[model samples]
Target: MTPPSDPARIPGDAPDESELGRIAADLGLDIGAQHLAEYRLLIKQGLGGYSRLDELTSPPPTARHYDRDPGYLPGPDENPYHGWAWRCSIKGAPHGPLAGRRVAVKDNISVAGVPMLNGSPIMRGFIPHEDATVVTRLLNAGAEIVGKTAVPAFCADAAGLTGLEPQPSNPYDPTRLPGASSSGNAVVIVSGQADLAVGGDQGGSIRLPAAWSGCVGLKPTYGLVPYTGAFPLERTLDHVGPMAATVADCAAMLEVMAGADGLDPRQQLDLAIGSYTDMLEEDLRGLRVGVLREGFGIPGVSEPDVDAAVLAAAGTLARGGAEVMEVSVPLHSDGLSIWSAIVFQGATELVTRGDAIGANWNGHFDLDLVDFYRRAKPAHPAEFSPTVVFTVLFGTYLTEQCGHRYYVKAQNVARELGRQYAAALETVDVLLLPTAGMKATQRRTDGSIAQIVARALGNMHNTAPFDATGNPALSLPCGFSDGLPIGLMLVGRRYDDETVLRVGHAYEQLRGPLAVQPPKLADRR
Candidate 1:
């Protein structure tokens, strides 16, 4: 086909023939000269609508309900554990459930006026214009927003080593890692910097850190908490939940955070929010607990002492009058592979290519963030952490070679995985496992790419699957191994978070308080 001698060009800049040819080459399309002109005319027609849309003003920004300051970066004395990303105090409603409690929000969640780095230099100067749904909820419930906690870059690394400055180390032992992504939240909660916290989890970010830091973390059922205003990795697997020093505190936070906010397509409109704190009073009497056999004794990954400690914790549930039995869901062992494929590909598309806010979702999009990242990332690609670089490279390779075939297959398999867990949940109210296969590992100053990647993901085997399946899983300090905390995980049926918390609270009562002391901080007074 031949084009008309002169094409009707849009007033603004449009792709010329040379640029079009390059795009065609990139897409592997063979367009002869004659056809190229015809395609160019068609492309110009498409740009006309975009040009019209560009002239319109954006919708009004969400109104800020509470006052807050542009928080400051704390010094060594103020942030001894390096757990804080930024510090400021935003008091909420004068009276409510959390009236006087202090809360640390993971840096990934937006707090309107505060700088949110999301634990990466690439996002350095970006300040959100609106609060994340969870943040707003926390404020409405009368909690004080004390500061932003650190996270691994893009919340990708599990070791907590690959992010912005002031990376958090374990409160129990500064030489070891606290855990990743939600690393600083755990440290702050355990060290008494904050009474509670909000943490995001795609693949065990909340639970792993809470486990290693001897605190309580809950990855509420996917979409139970609206993810609006937070930097998302993958839509399907994204979750934001509560982390605290005790199960009761976690429940109280969840009570405030859970509910549909009219934004965030991730949340279902009809989903009912529960009174999570009330469930804490319920004993574990007659509750059936399944100790997942596959969750322990990984040939190379699980440490013997860690396994023994978790098994002992499960026995404590038995002594609390719950019926305990061994149950095996062999597919549980395959969760990591499934989660890896989804996160690697999905995050690459959503975060790297889509600029942290992907397309095809009906939710409040933070255009400012999208614009900032689009400009910043290209200018400083070298500043991205190792995990970010690997995901981009590997995901791009998979997309170029196999397309979304692997991701699709993994999603399909993930549904089966969910079914397998559901079938197990049919008989038992909760499933028990080691939150992490081993205790906190020593921080390595240097290593090969393989070693670094392994250290980042090695502890996620048992916890990652539940994220993929969208089940409510809680991790609490079960015991101590080699002076580090060992986490016991309790996973319940979808939306049955109350039952999970009930069990965890009952077990906490029987086990007594964790013997580990908070890391002594330099006195600020």
Candidate 2:
């Protein structure tokens, strides 16, 4: 990289005295007119370097490394469940671990020439010029790019509701919602549209959908997989990982996707990627499973059938030679509150103020996406969904009224939460819990604002906390309730994703296949 030119002794892009006074008033500063002139001159002097920056050329965009066509959006006939955002075939390497396997890339993830809506009309015509790191890695491992799965607008809702047409529905029951914002990733997997998928999770997006749709989804240990080109919600909570029809496929995909890509700041410098597939055959002979007691019996959230199913699944794990014991971490119940405080303020700072690409971080930044988002959001404000609108409003209010105190406090609390969970994990290999307190919820198009909000965020209690702690959490199909699939979640120590997968695989072997079948696409049509 070349250094920028030296600053010239010329005033450039500095605010005038009047503008500076207004800015100071907006920020609640008490600078007098006497000091305003001095501040203006000093500001102009400080801004002189930016003139050189403006004259210098920017670095070129990442070059496209593979051949691909601009994929077309699928019509109703082809997308009965509204799972696909765009469809195309981009073949990968001739042979590798995932050769011939079709994989779905979530729309929030960039795929070079593919049009990524991200379930929001605000970004309707934008096309990514570079593939996300996960996309490139998957293609390198011989997994053919099949399609981009749909998500809730800006991936803000977990109920699969979007501002655009054809909202995603549960594969088991069309009238119900498939969990989101990895809604379509789960849909395509259960419908057999793809063999594997890459799902982004901030707060239970991957695991919630997998639970409702009967697929295996793993939110790998935070930073275990790079998030270079994905649309992020909150940086601290953002995670990209694998989802598949089975644990083996999920593990195989993780083997390819996990590893620092040098472009993501979220990954630690000393991080070591595990061989997830190699540990799948490991038995559960001495694995101690702690059934998190607080993960069950929420006042309004937990359903009897869902809890019963998860407990039964634990019993099955015990039958397979694993020690199952109930453990309580009182702080576990407060995970969602801590997550909200951080996300609300953090997202507003990064997305609303920072143009979705915050500063003060050293890593690859997609300037093209940032430029587009900056231009598009202001022009098409109404295109934002209710969920997104609420997030912005709430987050902005929090920041404006409270400053960073709440966010700072929440982060401090989150560290303690991680310590408590780590202490509990010291005696056990993994913590077992229900992925969500309930099963798939019924789709409601007409409801009060409170009802809609409740539907979108109500089921995230069990899954959100792990995101805060950066624990490797996996959701796998465990049982069925009233013909709907129930999910059992396994959480392991940080960077211990392989053990989580191994335990999930062991449980899969112990329990026979789920009895309910995926609804036929033709029947829906």
Clashes of each: 0, 0
The deviation in Å at residue 96 for candidate 1 is 0.9
Compared to the true structure, candidate 1 yields what TM-score? 0.96
| Candidate 2 deviant stretches above 4 angstroms | 1-13, 520-525
Best-matching candidate per lDDT: 1
lDDT score at residue 7, model 1, on the 0-100 scale: 20
- Tens-digit lDDT string for candidate 2 (294-355): 99998899999999989998999999989999988899999999998988888888877888
Cα error, residue 111 of model 2, in Å, equals: 1.0
What digit string (tens of lDDT, one per residue) describes model 1 on residues 422-505?
A: 999999999999999989889875778777777887788998899899999999998897789999999999999999999999
Best by TM-score: 1
Determine which window of 10 residues in candidate 1 has minimal summed lDDT: 1-10
